[model samples]
Target: MKIAIIGTRGIPNHYGGFEQITEQLATGLVERGHSVTVYNSHNHPNVAKSWKGVSIQHCYDPEHMLGTAGQFVYDLNCIRHARKNNFDVWLFMGYTSSSVWHSFFPKNSIIVSNMDGMEWKRTKYAKTVQRFLKYAEKLAVKHSHFHIADSPAIKDYLDKKYSVNAKFIPYGAVLPAASEEETLRQYNLAKDDYFLLIARMEPENNVEMILDGFSASNCKKNFLVIGKTENKFGKRLVGKYGSDNRIKFLGAIFDQETVHALRANAQLYFHGHSVGGTNPSLLEAMASGSLIAAHDNIFNKAVLGNDAFYFDCAACVKALLEKTVCTETKKTFTRNNTEKIRQQYSWDKIIDAYENYFFECCQSAKNESYVSSKRWACK
Candidate 1:
């Protein structure tokens, strides 16, 4: 099957969850004897003609100049290219802007969309913009031949909201082996001496609440935050909580090995994302064998089960920090989560599931085509 992957900044993941999964899925598909083309943003840092065995097609994206509005233009450009190429499937990773172009999609291709979390519910956008996103989401569901949900919570939401069944394909993470703490030396850190939180700087991520709780805690260990502090929300957080000596803001680190090392060496990894399903960071934390303290929500509960601690506010976090977490307990949590990951979130299993679904959709389309031809002959 000829597959075209659209709706991300580009692959080799300079960004977050979608890009990471896209790179994995595309490369895996190619290895299984399928032709795959991944659309890339012209501004992607590692933009190349091809990476591994997957083909890369760069499109015009002016997001740097026009901000969010430029994404729509980029998606439209990709759609135009896909239409001319006659792909059997167009796998969209997100529909933030492309859903509006549902009518323009080529008739010959099947539309399989991954319905991301409730993007419209994010607190970062204005009310009007959020409303627009909600509308866009509806259109995406209406037009897609099939949709994918990464978590049980998300699958339930779509089933309730649209009364439609979607394919449940969660993201996967690799278990990290212990590596040298070369990156932590720069921040004056050592193994298991600090708490860590790594995520994008956004309102929905609850960076302030995590910092507030860490600052108020009686624990003497440092709290290391690994995200860029140049955003408005990030700057405000620094100004408000910068006085705490125990808190350290180490700006964004994109190196995967360094990220794994940081997670592996931390005493605990805090995840405060309240708006997404199956967060990549959370999976990474689990894979690194780190004890996790995630936000109190269905999404977090669904992933961590009994292996993690939960917190909803600064007070809850402060209280949890006061206790002495024993090594035996940490070891048990790590062992349990590691087993769970192997059983449910392995990369090889995820790749196989995707390939099977893609082939099933193609086969279904062929069957329908055969029936339609017979009906035409009878007429």
Candidate 2:
């Protein structure tokens, strides 16, 4: 099937969850003898002309004020391309941007939209943007032939808020590259020596809270946070926390091997995302066999299982620190849970799920298009 994937920064996946999923899924589909084209942002310098047997269509847009509007501009360009491509299916990865394209595409086109978290609820957007997002989200849900929710929490949110039925498919992760010894040596630390936090340093991710909590912790272990220096929030975080050598802030790590090594060998993985569905980083850490200490959200709990430790604030940190080695039963449970994640959340399982969804949407589209054409001919 000819598939067009829309709504992301672009193909090489230097950035976020959607891009990573797009890269892996596109490659996997290509290997399975499906023709896939990923719409990429020309603004991203590292994006190649082509990638992994998939065509990368570069969509150009001016950098206006830099944020949601910029995204909309890029997405509009992608939609223009999507309308021209005549793809068997258009798989939209984001909520706010792709829904607007529904009016442009064939109504019978296999439109599958991923209801990626509640974008309106995110703290980053302004009141006007939030209002627009709420509308776009509604249209995306209302128009799509199929909807994908990355976690049960997201699926439930859509069901409750939008009264829309969405299929739940969790994100997958690859294992880390760094060996236990090498991982420890690279960081110049023993196992469990540092509290590691991996996330985009955005307000929604609770970056400040993570830093403050670690600083407030009387625990012996140092804190190591990894993320991209994206905006003012990141700058402020660096200014506040980066000065402390103990609070090592590694910014924007692109090398997967290095990231995996750090994640896999960390004494503990600190997941600070207060919002969003099944985080790819947290899942990757689990796949890497890191002892998980995540924010106690439903999404995190659902992913980590009851075996993992959860904390909301400084007091929670004190409890987590005190219970570290004493919770051998918890460790054992988490280890077993890791094995489960490795099996269930593997790339193979995820790719297969995507393939099935694609084909199903494509076939449905074909049937509906045929019926529409027949009616037009009769008229």
Which candidate has the highest lDDT of all?
1
Candidate 1 local lDDT, 51-89, one digit each (tens): 998999999998899988999999999888888886778
Counting only residues 3 or more apart in sequence or on different chains, how many pairs clash (N, Cα, C under 3 Å) in candidate 1?
0
Model 2: CA > 4 A from native: 64-67, 177-186, 366-379
Q: How big is the positional error of residue 181 in model 2, measured in Å on the Cα after superposition? A: 4.4
TM-score (all chains, Cα) for each model: 0.95, 0.90
lDDT per residue for candidate 2 within 1-81, as digits (tens), equals 778898888868778899999989999988988889998888776567677789889888555457556777788888887
Each candidate's root-mean-square deviation in Å? 3.2, 3.4
- Model 1 RMSD in Å is 3.2
lDDT score at residue 363, model 1, on the 0-100 scale: 70
